[model samples]
Target: MPKIALHNRDGSSNGTVDLDDAVFDVAVNVPAMHQVVTAQLAAARSGTSKTKSRGEVRGGGKKPWRQKGTGRARQGSIRSPQWSGGGIAHGPSGEQNHVKRVNKKLKRVALRSALSDRARSGDVRVVDDLVFEAPRTKDALAFLDALEIGSRRVLVVMAARDQVTGRSFRNLRRVHLLTVDQLNTYDVLVSDVVIFQRAALDHIGKGSRPDLGQRGRRPSAGTRSDDADLGQRGRRPSAGSRSDDADLVLTGREQE
Candidate 1:
């Protein structure tokens, strides 16, 4: 474990902070990092691809001509894959899967490796705490300035869920927030520096933390889940639900 001096709002020494050496001090493993990142990115892609073969084509139910044509070549249905306006012949459609599996432990190791590399380079910033009187953008900016981390891409690792803190930084470019356990290689590699509130280190590790309430009030109509459920259950059925009856009536009229 390594200790770093956290600074106060006025640029004074706030306190000392210790980091998890296993995550921040391990030797850099470039190969492992690359593999993990590539694998994760690959896993995120949707493999929804398919192709319509000749057999799946429409409007090709009957043969166009007999096997022995009169002076002309034998023919099949016009909608056959071999003919114009026909379905594709083994051409790729859009319904295949393209997911790759990777070991979870290996992914964790790669994340730790990336964190260690960043830590070794002095790119990790540990802050005493980000206490804001209110959820103001200026207050957040001031904190960033106090730590001399302004103007750089930042990933703020918080100890607990702070909706105000998250929302305040939403409009800012190159700033992100993640809880400790939620830390991943994508975020760690994308940012130039990682900032964590002092208490966040322990809170983000393994247990549940308090959710910082939202700054603004929410709409009253959809405020709670139970209310939404009740409203949905109270609604009447629609005309679409009688589609079967309508179809039966239409068929009866045709028969008559």
Candidate 2:
């Protein structure tokens, strides 16, 4: 287990917390991190860049000159690639797929590797909490200043429900706010320091793996076992009820 110094919102020391060895003390895999980070960056591309080919250009319907009997070399459409202001050749067609496929296990390994690297470099910090009465940019800055985190790129990981803290840090230029669920290899590798809320750290530690919490091991609201049972009951009457109804119907027929 790797232990990191814990701090209050005001930067006061508040004991320490043990980070999960699986997450923070594992062997760093550089190649896995590189592949994951590359894939992440590739996925962010819009891939919408496009260029018009000669055939698709507006003015290409008319040829520039006859194919022969001209002093100059024969010419085709004015929109040919050789002509100025003409359509581009072999250019992007707006259908590019820059996304690289990385397996879930590889992604997890990469994230853990990045985190372990950061932890070994002593760039990981834990804060007790980031409760904010209101969204205050000044308070956010003060928190960073108290931690002596200067102008470096700081990645703050917090619980998803902490909207107030997120709002406070959103305006900071170098401070990136991400929920625990959004933590990934690229963000972790690009950051100079990682600040984890105590709650977020505990949540990560409770999981067996980096992304285990998101794997839907337990059913969520509206999808519980009880709900499924209720759905089954609503769809079909019980055997006892059917037998009782049949007996009642037979007795009614006998009386009739």
Best by TM-score: 2
Candidate 2 lDDT tens digits, 1-256: 6778999988999998888776787788899878867766666566789999888888767877888788889887789999988989999999998877776666667677888899999999999987788889899899999999989888887654456676677667577665565566666777799998887787676651233222111211122122210111111111111111111111111221
Model 2: CA > 4 A from native: 66-71, 208-256
Residue 2 CA displacement from its true place in model 1, Å: 2.2
Off by over 4 Å in 1: 9-11, 48-92, 203-256
lDDT of 1 at 135: 64
Q: lDDT scores for all predictions?
A: 0.57, 0.66
Give candidate 1's TM-score. Answer: 0.62
Error of 2 at 148 (Å): 0.7
Model 2 clashing residue pairs (backbone): none
